[model samples]
Target: MKIATYNVNGVNARLPVLLRWLELAQPDVVCLQELKARDERFPEQAFHDLGYDAVWNGQKSWNGVAILSRVGEIHETRRGLPADPDRTQSRYIEAAVQGVLIACLYLPNGNPRPGPRFEYKLRWFERLEAHLGTLVSLDAPVVIAGDFNVMPTDIDVYVPDRWRDDALFAPEVRAAYARLLKQGWIDALRELHPGQHIYTFWKYWRRSFERDAGLRIDHLLLNPLAARRLKAAEVDRRPRGWDKTSDHAPVWIELSDKPVRARTRKDASSHR
Candidate 1:
């Protein structure tokens, strides 16, 4: 199955662009972040018309996540991070679709580091790490995809030196990302094309995309079982050049049926 993730920046603002990409990519499942809309205002009917079942967690004007699956039978597992007591932002959502556990996330940007926002970013990573630890115990094919707002390596950015002080490339942020991968989750894009300077996000200002200056902040992370089935992974950068486009483009991964074998074995062992 083909699974993809994209940070549309704002669901309302980029619906047209999103529709075009959806038609082009035609993924089996899609995870969206930065919806910037309220739950009531989400354009569910549009997705419904395309034969997709959508589960959305949205707030007003910022930080929302949603999943759309053409395969139908979407079962929402959770909405928002558990450890967060405030539950003020709609930044995380998880669902089971087509036998795969999918998570959509919009991690905090945490710009202008060495401050409260940065601290919050680190704390958020810790919470996410803890959550992922629990997910691994399920022994299912799982994928966590979103705009993580992190550059996992220097090769991920166009000019690594230019982003040294930015929150996305800071050592602390990279370490947090490393910790996530250390939990047996594979970075799908990197796995497909190692040591490649590929980017999925580019700033609108300063002709970033025109100059091929971008950062690989968006990602599709797969668990060990899921990784075993990964067939292909890529960033669809062409969509970002379209009119009224989001700063981010779609990143996707294709998985074969190998993971089902591992899942079945684990299930059998548990029953013993």
Candidate 2:
């Protein structure tokens, strides 16, 4: 199966570009972020017409997430992160598509740090860590894919020093992400193309795309069960150059069909 993630920026504003990319890329499952629309405002019909069934958690003019499936129905598992009861931002959504547990997320961009927004961003990471702890206990094949809004390493960004103080490259943010990786989730793209400077997002200002000034903030993190089946991972940078396109491009991963056997009671008992 092929799964992809793209931060569309604004579903309505970039509808045409999104449609064209959907046709060209044709990912079997897609995780979209930054819808910037309310639930009622989501253009379900447009995606439906393209043979995709979508479930979205949205809010007006800001963060939102959605999962689109082509093979079967998308069953909503969760609407938002349960760890933060006060989190009203529509930045996350989880669903089951073709037996795979998928999480679509749009992490906060805590710019102009040392303020309330930055504090919120750190607190959000704490919530995400808590959610991940629960997810690991399930031991199910899970895929967390989205625009993380974080530059994971120097290799993930065009110039690490230039973005030192930027929200995406913050040290604390990077440490939080590292903790997530330590929990056994594999970074699919990095694993596939080790040491490659592949980027999924570029700033619109200063001809960032043209100059190849980009960052690999978007990602696909898979549990061990899913990681074992990962066949390939790539970023479709061409879409970013398209007319009225999103600042981000689609990051996709292909997985093998080898069924992941569930751990037996005996196996679980042995671990204890």
Candidate 3:
């Protein structure tokens, strides 16, 4: 199965670009972030017409997340982390699609570091860490995918020196991201193409996309079961170059038909 994550930036404004990319990529499942639309404003019928069933949590003009599956019914599991009931941003949404648990998230941008926004970002990451810890412990085939809004390592950014003071590349933010990986989830792109300069997001200014000056903030993280089934992962940079496209491109992973299972002695003999 092919699964993808895209931060559309503004769903409505970028609908055409998004539709064109969807046609070309044709992923079985997709996690979308930054819808920038309200629940009622979401173009459900548009996706339905594209033969995809979607479950989304949308805010008026800010954070939002959605899961779209072309194969199975998307059964929603949750909206946001239980750690913060007062958190009203529509940044998270989880669903079960094609027997896999998918968590779509749009983490806080946390710009202008050493401020309250940065603090909120850390707090949000803590909640995510707690929630992901519970999910990974279950050892289910889970994929937590979307725009994490942080450059976990210097390798993830194009010009590390320029972004030293940026929240996305800050030491504390990177530490939080490391804590998440310690929970046993595999960063799909990095795991697949280690030591390669792969990126999923580019800025609109300064000809960032033209120059391929980008960052790998958008991610598809897999739990143990899903990681075992991982066949390939990539950043679809073509869409990022399209007309009026999102600053972020799509990142995807392909998995085998079935989840990997431990081989028993009898099973091993049968294979042999």
TM per candidate comes to 0.94, 0.94, 0.94
lDDT digits (tens) for residues 66-144 of candidate 3: 9999999889999998878656799999998877899999999998888998989989999999899788745458899
Q: Native-vs-model 3 lDDT?
A: 0.88
Worst 10 residues of 1 by lDDT: 261-270
Q: What is the C-alpha lDDT profile of model 2 across 1-272, one tens digit per residue?
A: 89999999999999999889898888999999999999999999999999999999989999999999888988899977876766679988999887789999999898878788888888888999889767743556789999988988999999889999988899999999998887767798987788999889999999999999999999999877787678889999888998888999999999878844454453344224
Best by lDDT: 1
Model 1, span 1-272: residue lDDT tens = 89999999899899999988888889999999999999999999988887788999999999999999997689999998887865988889999987899999999999879899898988888899999877754668899999999999999989789889999999999999998876667798887799889999989999999998999999998877787788899989888999999999899999997753234443344324
Indicate the TM-score of model 2: 0.94
Q: Clashing pairs in model 2?
A: none
* Root-mean-square deviation of candidate 2: 3.2
Kindly report which residue stretches of model 3 are placed more than 4 angstroms away from their true locations once superposed.
259-272
| Model 1: number of backbone collisions | 0
Over 4 Å off in model 1, which ranges? 259-272
Q: lDDT, candidate 3, residue 51?
A: 91
Q: Estimate the TM-score for candidate 1.
A: 0.94
**Residue 187 error for model 3, in Å?**
0.4
